[model samples]
Target: MSQSPEKKPRLDDPCINLNLEMNRKAHYTDSFENPSLIVRRGFPINITTTAPIDGVKLVYIAGTKHPQRDSQRLFGWKLETKSSETNNYQLTPPSNCAVGRWTIKFTIDAKEVEMQATILFNPFCKDDQVYMECPEEQEEYILSDTGLVFIANSWRIKPQGCGWVFGQFESRVLECCLALLERSPLTPTSKSSATLVSRSMTALVNAQDDNGVIEGDWSGDYSGGTDPSEWTGSVDILLQYLETEKPVKYGQCWVFSGVLVTVLRALGIPCRSVTNIRSAHDTENNLVIDIFHDRHGNRLESDDSVWNFHLWNEMWTKRPDLPDGCDGWQALDATPQEMSDGCFQAGPASLNAIKSGAVYLPYDARFIFAEVNADRVYWREDSDGNYRIKKIDKKHVGRMVVTKAIGCNDVDDITDQYKHKEGSEEERYQTRLAVTFGTEPDIYENVEDEDEVKMKFHCEEDYIIIGQPIEYTVKLILKDMERATALFNATASVYGYNGKFICNVQSHKCELLLPEQKVFKGRIESSEYESVVRSGSIIKISVMYDLKEATDMGFLEEEIPLRAPPPKVEILSQEPYIVGVPIQLKFSFKNRFSSALTGGYFRLDAPGFSSRDRLEIDQKLLEPGIECSYRVEYKPRKKGKINLVVSFNSDQHKGLHTYKHINVQNSKSDDF
Candidate 1:
């Protein structure tokens, strides 16, 4: 009898077993072990087969639907024989492969077996577009999941670093990120390009355009959804979206940015949240923020206003679509501030282009340029009801642009990276260049300086913390030696961060003779505005001067941000906490207000140590001058330095958060 034909290898044969865990550590994706194998592009991942088989050809297909040949490739494996019956194959995805789930078909003779894997952007690979040359940046932007989001107005209060848990490597986050891309209108070809993906993500992060992720609610009423301030991380929001296939109820600028950073980082593209203090929302794209006021110096409702601070995201990638040298950090906003191409998306605009004032480039560069360098033009309604420019503020729009520093929680001021020094020659030149391409190129033409009397405001304290009296001084200086009498009015109002008027706190009016220099002091007690210090609200003190000697009036305003003191956190567990070991933490806060604080609650969030849901403890009331404390237990799941954030909120106080860094040692040894 002829030799029996060799048995054909079957798809379900026990001879072949894929090693899903192989090369995951090298790809920096060992943290994700779920639905399928996770690997980054431009890196070699080993797939082992139990039984060695000859004539095996592997074909890789990228994406799930309508897979194209451009993204598909065939590779003949060298087949490293691990043992007598086992073989390991190393497969390297193309550097430009589309990111998402990929199918790998193993062709043995005429038979085929298919396996699945997920591919991500490779910032570590040189050939990849998102490649980051610096090793430290790759660690901080791509690897470090916990970061700080700087809060507070830079001019009024010092920008404080608020701990934000990115949770990029959390369970189902990678899946959710891929699912988000699939939900968008991006094709497989567009998904392959980092620039396109980032641009698309800007719209996908908010539900305004595509029913994407977070539903933005700036209405101050968060009855049906969670308050934006209560959110400590993005994992819960994303998982909820993945589960419900609906937008998460409410998010502001920071929330949108936090979630975008998580999605970008989860896709293996380096990203960080950026805070632009005194950021402008230029609705007209005229390179000017117009503030119309009555002849008496009261702020009138207008179309354009400058936010106390605005938060957006910066993603690192090469912009091949633009000219050369635009290959670094690109600004992208998902806050739905304005529309781009009929969609609520902002950038992927190159920071290099932005710094150079090349606003003529693509993807909402004019809007972003105006955000950082727009001139604030004060327009006063004259007796004839026509608005005329009284004062032009060129340096107040973008005071300090900042982000979380590398390897630490401290703030890294990248203001210089975004623009030159304020009032500098280069800054002025760039501003002019930007205005040339703006909607109103002649906006600065014939703008006469009508201010004969100059006024300035200064805060007495280094920081005007909440629950303390605010003391500030207003000074008037005659630009020239001319005797003049002027009527001065100073009004203080509680304004939302978005420039919405909340409630007026105090107002003062007086007539004074303009000496060479005149100074006036004002005070507003904590009791006057303590109840109105909602999340991100600031005290705007506007001073209007009616000069008897001149035809034009003077308007000067200062935004005073009241800083909320962080709550205290104490780790009850002993030092040298180990992985998988239970650790107790105690959170406490003293009610500094004179009145009782009702609806008080404590929110605890620790990325690696706790579950996706934040631990919330309810307290009906916190007596004045009394310290309230809550204790909870958590088990360390992984070994590393993790940030534990504790936030305290009540009907009386909002936006009080604190964080503690805890070192979790490996259970195998003392090494962290």
Candidate 2:
């Protein structure tokens, strides 16, 4: 009689909890496996459970927080089960899905389970339904305010602190952007984004103001300021101009493109930042950057120059005005170098136009093509000042153009997508086709030289601290016995990223015999020019020499003595902080230079810090030789090791950072 025990709980009953199967969780991995998994929008999301359920519903919520299912839910989806215990839901997240960490609540009858997932906007998605709505672009490019973008000095995308944090328009920023937008005659049409982006190309750069917005100084230094993060974000750039009606100081190609990304995204256009290494600015549209040198091996200045890296923006949209397949990923350059129409804007240069060699596209397709795929033509000058194409290098122009991966920290190489691989027959043909568009093909005979003057020009170190000296050693080996006297001249000028000339710092001119006198040197004491220089400024050194008094010249260009301002803030804190314990974080702001600092403000920004932790300096002016100290009392809200970053900005000094880390111990009494 007592053998009739209590019945076992049924699997489908609300009392029985549903948990994800261990094998399912272990095997179904995402490309990026942080606490939150990232899945491309328009792709299938599969979930395998250990228990069978009657029905399933998914509720998307912002961030990782999950309150009881209610109207606060972003969206809900009824999942379709592949089997009783497996959920192979082919759910495509719309582009409008918020870009950030999101929690998805899976409701299985009365029991519920939740997991963290991040939805990313993928521009390359080809699904007709997704593309028609273009949700990915709408969410990522237009709606999202902040994101990670890649910037580089060269092809290889190693994080040398080159990645930039980009913030688009918030409410205040949007207000200013709207006012600016009114000035431009842009209306919502099929080609509205392309048109607005074109206007932004020139409008973002203050060409009229010297050292303000964009510094195109080729003779001077290129440093806009201490750090790229000094502007804080795109909104800060707009507010500075809108409030003051004065052009903001400092901006490079990256800065210009970053601002363009903000403006375009704010206006409901899909956009992102792109960087091209060894990028060419084909001012003449000849598809060749011609450099002339005297008979000796010295480099001379030309109208066309190649930058270390070039930054531009790409907006995703449909091109009803253009032919088919040229609809997505149009390049928009905000850097005020080349002018499109009467303004300094560039594309909506269709990448498809780039691939297809469609030079007749609405925007500047040929210019964008040359930027990433142009062949460099090195011209040699003779004794009579006559020059011939010495050598053409097709392989060195574009190497590794990269952008931030859709949902991760890694870089995504879109080089091949922009142009065919170097040395490929298709690439050569495309180059010729792209160059010869709307013009008769000229036979480039004798472009390759049988004998070329080999020169080695390098510095002891590529980077030098501000207030230091930089030395460049040049060596030339003559291959022709007919070469006579060589006149070597090395000129150093400071310049901004906008390619504008600042000031000539140093110049050395001398005569040497060919083959006998091959070595020449030049030095620059950066400290002498420290007062006029900032970090990211360029010390452009050009060495040009003539051989046998022949006009055939050889040229070498090098940038030396990179400068950065001294740090303004210092941090000191004890590690292993305990949760619920008040921690004393001490820091100091000391002016390192002779001048006073005005309008100084510092902000404490991190996940672990409270919003009220930021503060401005009590005194508007920070006097030289004075050290200001501050002590902040902070308590750990969560138990973990966390990084805190404090950034300082002012009218005198633009960028400075103080960072600290603290590990908090979890305790029973530490519950918030």
Candidate 3:
């Protein structure tokens, strides 16, 4: 508050700033109660001496959370240096402090300087507070020790502090941790944010590797590209899948736990990690009860959601004798999944193996979970001072929850909406459901049981048109196709380049007399890319269809499904299809109001597409509002279901696709 910009330097040029950056302050704060908060505001202490002081010393005194018997005196200590500045001096608290009135005394060239601060024994209030007011709750941030996360509070995502892993990247994790630690108090009794930040930074520097990487034991590889923005770091899913499929697999992901443990241990910060069972991601990643093993030679396996592979650390006071409220340890993690992107607190139930010592094992009974979770990390902090978590990370899905979220794959490029199906965890958090099974986000005119409504749409699964006219067919299917003559509507366009006209259809549908496929004989003209662009641009030929809720005048057990066999746009061309080369993509399609247009978005991910081995386009805007076909040059990795991402600004809506290859299966390959 002293002039927002800079702190006024009292006294002149004979000063210096010392101490460590991050990760360095923790070890120095162990013996002190509630370390003072470190701030970015630099404090310069200059004492001009007639004759340079031989051994100058500067002292800072602060109080602990409570004035206990051991720390009889306040956290008071003097840092001695040959020069006055102490050159950014750092300190580790004395193993023992005589608990009493605390004060600081400094001497420069024998010119004495003194300051004092007090520690209070507020028995009624246990949580840390600065000034006279305390925060309702502390923001959770993940910290790593021994390559694992010590999850204290929830990260901003997944609201309400649910554990989630965003990505497995060091830079992202460091940025998140630093942002939070910079807010903690430095001294136990002192409300000094600067103190905490400075010390934490120092601690970080000491633990970093020569390559500047901060991980202790975790691998350096990270999955997913940044721009495409698909980050899945959930541990439970992986463990669950391994457990179910390869029940004899060894080595649980302890490297993650080790990272968290290492960070806390580096600074004498007491912490523990809690772990539990996890649900599966999809049919692809099933939670199988396999033989889970660790580097330490420990192994276990069971078909349990409560004991799945997981790791979260807990923070505690450095001393075993310290009381409950004397600045307890905090938890954090690099695994967004374990932390549920910061869903729970750093208390007892994070993960156990990640703790400094074997702490979580002994404190296992004190775990709890959420009860009525609308969207919250359920944990119990009862009046009895006991803590527990239940329903450990539930992906309890029901009904038919469809999401507008698409998968980040080739077919659904970056432009499509993500289509989430029923029974998937993403069905709730990612996709768009027409009608929810559990809770309804909105009630859009709940029609009577016998009422009928019509939905229509136009779609196309496109390929190149060589030289001949490509005939395509579109259909609308129903459970009782024989009962209702499902109304169908569609339009087709045969336009040349820029503006050269061809033909257009405003509306059309299926009929027993009319042809199901359209013929475009001599519709395409051979020309260069530039010549094609020179002619007017091509237009889309669309077909629309709809069906009303079947009404046999009485009982129909289930609602009939209307299917629009996504229209095909194949280009009959003279140029042959390359086995492994990208050709200019020139295709078009139409849109209708179809239920399958779930999120109006999709992704097109072709493996052998880019020469640079990079994918950068997002293609999910193919919905009705944005009509027509798209033209772009793209290469295919292999033959399969060409997905098209159809969402706009829907970061979570990159479409999911199942690529189909001739005589081949798409296994979950390790991208890293």
Candidate 4:
């Protein structure tokens, strides 16, 4: 008997289906866990070639976070191949591939799809744990005695790269050796632990597997003992330098040393393949020096070979760590060591590296670069196993497995490479910037205070680069100049994001600088005058400047701190107990002095005051007279009155409550 039709299921079930955010992430897969030294998978990558070639190395390329535009740390290729066929997933790198943390990238064409994996031997970070924004300006660079990092360029700033690309360009790499002196010149930080860095250097030298070698030749290698100092000469020796300090742009060209650096990075080592392609004929080296202004020549205007010949990078291996605390690989490898010490101990021929006779020519070949002769060094140990870097010769040097693609000369194909992108010329007309005013929403900010206005204007990121020195003449107007003058001595800053040419204006009505290069002398100023009063400022003002990179949103931003913790509670009344009697509860409260509270929340919880059937329920806010009242009515099912408690929470206030004890009574009993 189908008992009168069973109730139909409700179509609307309240189940929340999650919509997760999928991203293109880079990671290394671990094969082992417990002992944690195994790697299992690596994302396959291929060059942007159509009919992929044979023996061409392709490595993971990560973007940089440097505000200067080029956000690249891991520059150059990641893998090397000499095979004469199509490169694919079938092509596996050596098992002992270089170790350490790296963001693995996936590429099929110009666009990239990314993923990530953590190898115990070289574990990848689990989260955006790489916090801490890097310095936005050269001035922000700090030489701290922190635990691991020594001299850091971008300190204290943590750039959050929200999308798939990591924010490392805005992150700091610790220089352990330099950090040694930070702890009062005695206690060293992780980066400064000379012993640990030296130990890793030993590991790197020892980890030199014969299979890792990719044979190649150095053009300047000698049969017997050779002198790198004699070949490259001391960088200190400036024979012909137009500029004594700033670097002279070298044009497109590739030497054998540049090839070596690229090969190393492919094998999972951090290396640079610099192209010091000279544009002018120096007649000294019988070759042209790579000059920026010139197509392909060296200048006798300033006979400087160090600045002319090649660009170099500081590379780190899985085993042999660098003396400095250089993590993974970096393009921002600039350090006081290399900059001050002058050159690499290991000459190109003596580096014991795999060589590749290759040349990569970018349009701006002057800026393009790779490794150099002095970049490599060796670990020397005596009877006691103490290690020091001993110079090595060419024979022991490793090889760069030159891919057959080396035979191809596709270097001159013109491609539009611009700062904001091509055909986007129009996009350049409009500039984007992050204008900072208050650290947080200064809803209570006193615009009247010149210091506050000065702080707001000064707080702008790279203000001068965008507007500085009152180019053509705009002004940062103070809304009520007379009124603002009464409270604030306002100042402003114009930056170029690099902090260079960062000008600070101590005046409220200073001239504005041109915001862009097109009109270096174009007039600019504070978009609007700041009002004397923040509450009534009809003017939502901004300082106009030329922005290097366009911002999606206009400047004049601020963040608000968490609202002050709110007020609290007090208890009032409850119902008397009985089976069928109506229950009542009351509470007492007054506005606590903190953030303004519009309303309050009351929580009514009962464990055993159950009514088989639904009981009547009522809750309401009472009007304010002398004492405000909260009233509620419910029927009691059992003998006793339940303990009713209330809590209040709001955006402006929190942590408030009180309790009302309801004593149930029998309606008919004489025990009133």
Q: Which candidate ranks first by TM-score, i.e. highest?
A: 1
lDDT by residue for model 2 (240-283), tens: 66777556656656667767777665444567878787788877
Model 1: per-residue Cα lDDT over 147-238, one tens digit each: 78877665545578887888888888888898887766777767788888888889999999788999998777788888788777788888
* Tens digits of per-residue lDDT for model 3, 1-672: 422222222323243222223422322221122223221111222223333332423233322323323222324433433454433433323333221133333333444433222222111122211111222111111121111111111111111111123211222232223222322233443322212322232232222221111222212122222211111121222222223422111112233333344333322233333332221111111211112222221222222222112343444332222234323333333232221212311233222221211222212211211100112122233346443231122232111111111111111111111123423565343222312322333322232232132222322313322211323443333333443533444444433211123444233444321122222111222221111111112334443323343321110111111111122233333243343544554333344322112223222333322111223233444454334444455543333323221111123222111221121123323121
Whole-model lDDT per candidate: 0.80, 0.57, 0.26, 0.22
Candidate 2 has its poorest 10 consecutive residues by lDDT at 24-33
TM-score of each: 0.92, 0.61, 0.26, 0.18
Can you give the lDDT of residue 263 in candidate 2?
64
Segments of candidate 2 deviating more than 4 angstroms: 1-144, 148-166, 175-184, 187-229, 239-252, 292-302, 320-324, 378-387, 393-396, 408-411, 438-452, 460-462, 480-487, 509-523, 549-552, 561-672
What is residue 529's positional error in candidate 3, in angstroms? 42
Model 1 misplaced regions, further than 4 Å: 1-13, 33-35, 50-86, 109-111, 294-296, 382-385, 608-619
Ranking by lDDT: 1, 2, 3, 4
Looking at model 1, residue 70 earns an lDDT score of 22
TM-score of 1: 0.92
Cα lDDT tens digits for candidate 4, 38-151: 132232232222333223212321112111122233332245443326332222222233222233333323223322222211122211111113322100111110001011
**Global fold similarity of model 4 (TM-score):** 0.18
Model 4: how far is 561 from its true place, Å? 62
What's the best-to-worst order under TM-score? Answer: 1, 2, 3, 4
